[model samples]
Target: MRFRIAAALLTTAAIGLAGCSTGAQASDPNGPLRVAVSPQPHGEILEFVDEELAERAGLDLEIETFSDYNRPNEALTQGELEANYYQHQPFLDEYRTEKGGEFAWVQPVHLEPLAVYSKEHRSLQDLPQGAKVTLSNDPANRLRGLKLLADNGVLRLKPEVSESARVEEAVAENPKNLELSTLSPDQLPRTVEEADAAIVNGNYALKANLKNPVAIESAEGSPYVNGLVTTPQLKDDPRVVKLAELLRSPEVAEFIRQNYTKETVVPAA
Candidate 1:
């Protein structure tokens, strides 16, 4: 009877030890960190860092790519992704306010300047009166394009309008009577021939071979700084903190400089 009791106690201790071991492994610091990214430069840039730096930092980065601008945030908020790297602060702020998503910015990663491109006109000055202009239809980018227009002195906005200003909110003064048309961001390049000019995001511009943008957002003092963001729950996670640091590293900066060229996508260091 005593032998059986001793054996049972030994078995229980072994099981307890095994449970502790499993718990420790589950909480390992070097576990994989899942990150969702938008297609093109954002995902491509993350791949570069994942291959070159993440491993060295004892991090295994799992990248999930999405085609739409809205899915990355949705996936992150749903806890399906650890973090995302596809939006600027303004867009993120708007999303959180409008959708009630609980997320926060980890840090600014890169800046993709919104550029006003034209196939017909070389400069804004050449654009004739009542010329049709194509802007992004998305709520976030519409505001960005409006700000870009305001910056170029093409139109004057109300004094109350800020960087978060949208087309509906704009109070045009001496507007040159330009006819503004909003379209999907992807279609901006395609509409260039039909419209006098189009505001194109940098990624789409790069894909469509429209590199030398006639006018680009001034990166020096621009408010549109792209960033890495995660749910508020994971904000304190060490892996998230490490990834944020890796984003601003020398390696990432060098990669951006070599890959993007000509200050189109500047590192937000």
Candidate 2:
């Protein structure tokens, strides 16, 4: 309850937003460990920790909730935040590769499965031919959606296509001839009313309160485990290490299990 929540909004038209300070100096070992996170599960989980566990553990946590996918890592890299906790390995890897930052992946906390959801349709097979299928515009996530469709037999990806292949190049066949459209990840859940089907990230779906996805990606062998990230310099800091440890503890895992369905959020093994 003593922790503060800063809301950062990112419009799809303008991704570059002015940075807001967390008032947490990374150089101060005893100061609050500031972390940037997505609003739904990430922010909620951190809130639970800050309220129920952090004080007892001798940790001070300041949680900032970002609606945008790109800004948390940017804030962390710019020294505006001590750490961040919203992205999975693939997304983080892409950001580090493209931005040339040394953010360390501290620990895997949970997996938010990517799922296919629709308002008018009951299943992926129920989707009509030439139906509009919406997906995330971000490259890594776009590929993830494409793969999810391929895995479900709604489409087929080119065997020769690499992870970095263009979305168009990745698709070898569209049996339903579905028209694919890309939008910001936050916009995906809203597409339920407009698009015939949409591949949505779990947190967004949970935010939108969309229950019963037609198809959800399996947690088994999934590489998209959401975790904590910090600068290499602070990777081994006791506070960072402790936070990571608490995130993966049995108590936190039990909280995730109690609060969300396994298909929506699975604690990382």
Candidate 3:
């Protein structure tokens, strides 16, 4: 896991060294809206808009599919993409704070609920001591995933920890001493099949066809619904507005609500 993280960091650094637009040649006022997206719901939803509604609305949509959780933000920051739809506001807040980038938020399109999946263990209680578990490593998601452990009595967290908490902030009262590993959200689904358990992002879960999670984040109060994001300068671009409007339309919402399992993917209101 350590080796994988190191390699991922190196990949990120390579992107920085190679990419240089800096959100300058940002977006076309009337051209295709180049947007980055995760491979599942984000990509699937955008493809729907692009094929079914874009021409009618006079919006030419170009979609860039990103399988890596970190790259979309980097691409958006580097102007390799005009906007992205693969992250929540918490992630955007953490990214802005970490990179000092001015990524702006549009409305949330859908919710990919975080879930705990395991091929080895049927439930959290079944997980034995020192069992290796993989989770999303990014600050916001690390906190959110860890809170599932805390919430389900598998572990305990420090008092006053809010939605933005990180793994290092976690003071676990884990009697089992479950060995925890943090990976990118995109990596968790695959790792869970090998490790004792994993807290996977719903998008990856469905993409990989991993099923029957032992635990899930509820839609009632979950905050990780993915939204459209853009550079501050392009926030009000007509293309962006049209894309956002189409994404949240009844048509798209019905597609999400029908095409995906309600437990794994929920259309955000």
List lDDT for all candidates, in order.
0.75, 0.85, 0.79
Q: Model 3 lDDT vs. the true structure?
A: 0.79
Q: Each prediction's TM-score against the native?
A: 0.85, 0.91, 0.86
Show pairs that collide, candidate 3: none
Cα RMSD to native, each candidate?
12.2, 3.3, 6.1
lDDT of 3 at 66: 57
Tens-place lDDT digits, model 3, residues 1-269: 00111334544553664465435454546556778777678878888887787778887777766556677787777766679898898888877777787788988888888889888788999999899888887778888888888878888898877655656567558778888888877778778658999898887789888788899888876678889999888898888888889999999999998899976788887
Candidate 2 lDDT, 154-230, residue by residue in tens: 89998866557777889999989999999998899999899999999999888889888899988889899999999
- Cα lDDT for residue 1, model 1? 5
Over 4 Å off, model 3:
1-17, 20-23, 162-168
Better of 2 and 3 by TM-score: 2
lDDT of 2 at 11: 31
Model 3 poorest ten-residue lDDT run: 1-10
List runs of model 2 lying over 4 Å from the truth: 8-26
Better of 1 and 2 by lDDT: 2
